[model samples]
Target: MPQDCERTPVVRDNGRHQWEKDRARAPRTVRATTGATERDTGLHPPDLVFHAEYRELPAPCPLAEAFGVPAGTLLLERSYRTRYGPESAPFALVTSYLVRGMIAANPDLLDATNEPWPGGTQSQLHTVGIELDRVEERLTARAPTPAEARDLDLPSGAPVIQLRKTSYDIDDRVVNIADVTLPADRTELLFTTRLERW
Candidate 1:
């Protein structure tokens, strides 16, 4: 997050010419039904390829308003949509989402940490997640290849973001699950963290 870190246009918007068209280039293929499903047959992959449907989250849930964050923050939310085929049931396992807070910009945060490689902009909290040389907060326990952009569940396009997270299930006095880990191979799992910005 630099002092001038800027927003990039998403492929879906008109901002990127040919982007939307490129993303939707080919329709997913549907396999023809093998008479087996009609008979008392064994299981098989669906005749239709798996797909996801997104309905943008409504304005402010209780959890969001509690923070009193600003407007136009890019919010991430877990969807409960259903489907029958794919590499796996990718979305159901997610427990949280991310939304940009409505706060003024700050990029001087770049030089504060011990990260060896401070990527392009090291100012914003969310973008800071990727800029880190590696996880040092003890929270970033899982590591995956950069190419494993799985969370969006879309078939193509470079994900605008990537995240690695760990969760703590605190119940009363005992820590039942300390830093229970969750990685967004396809969809990011965004929970609140106590770390400072940048």
Candidate 2:
């Protein structure tokens, strides 16, 4: 990590801006996801590298319950890591799941190579005709596992923030679920809510 590295502040108040499209932007290695948001922390998109691993597997019990699907339902599992430059540790570890049957309508959604998908997951869902309604996120903190500590290069005894994000579609169906592990030392969460006048 660079000595000048700043904590990555995740602004929850931004709402669904990641799902919005920017037509005038040029094609680049980074897309409008977490990587794009890192710019707010002084990280340049060109210096970030994203890696994704995709697989199809049976949904675990908890995931099945969340998706309202039977156990053993096939799901597309995506593991993501975005590192700043070549020598630094990943900003965070993200594992996202989507029901295979629901997204199978679009063949490209089944492939990981198509990722860093221009407008992120929302755009991919759009191709399958699913529109997002809202997203819910739950946060917790815990000591990192040995592997997590090694991957995120955390100091001894440092804790990590776990975020579970669930996305629902227009029909109120759970469309996606993601588990994100952020290094507490380098991650910040900000949330803002507006109150309507009485």
Best by lDDT: 2
The TM-score values for the models, in the order shown, are: 0.21, 0.85
Quote the lDDT for 52 in model 1.
26
Candidate 2 Cα lDDT to native? 0.78
Q: Using TM-score as the measure, which candidate wins?
A: 2
Tens-place lDDT per residue, model 2, 1-198, is 553556344433344434343421434343543444464356666667879999999998999999999999999999998876764678889999999999998999998898767667777787888888777889999999999999988877889999998989889999999998988887767666668999
lDDT, residue 141, model 2:
99
How does model 1 fare in lDDT?
A: 0.27
Prediction 1 TM-score vs. true: 0.21
Stretches > 4 Å off in candidate 1: 1-49, 57-61, 65-74, 78-96, 100-198
Q: How far off is model 2, as Cα RMSD?
A: 3.6
lDDT of 1 at 18: 23
- Which lDDT values do the candidates have, in the order given? 0.27, 0.78
Cα deviation of 133, candidate 2, in Å: 0.6
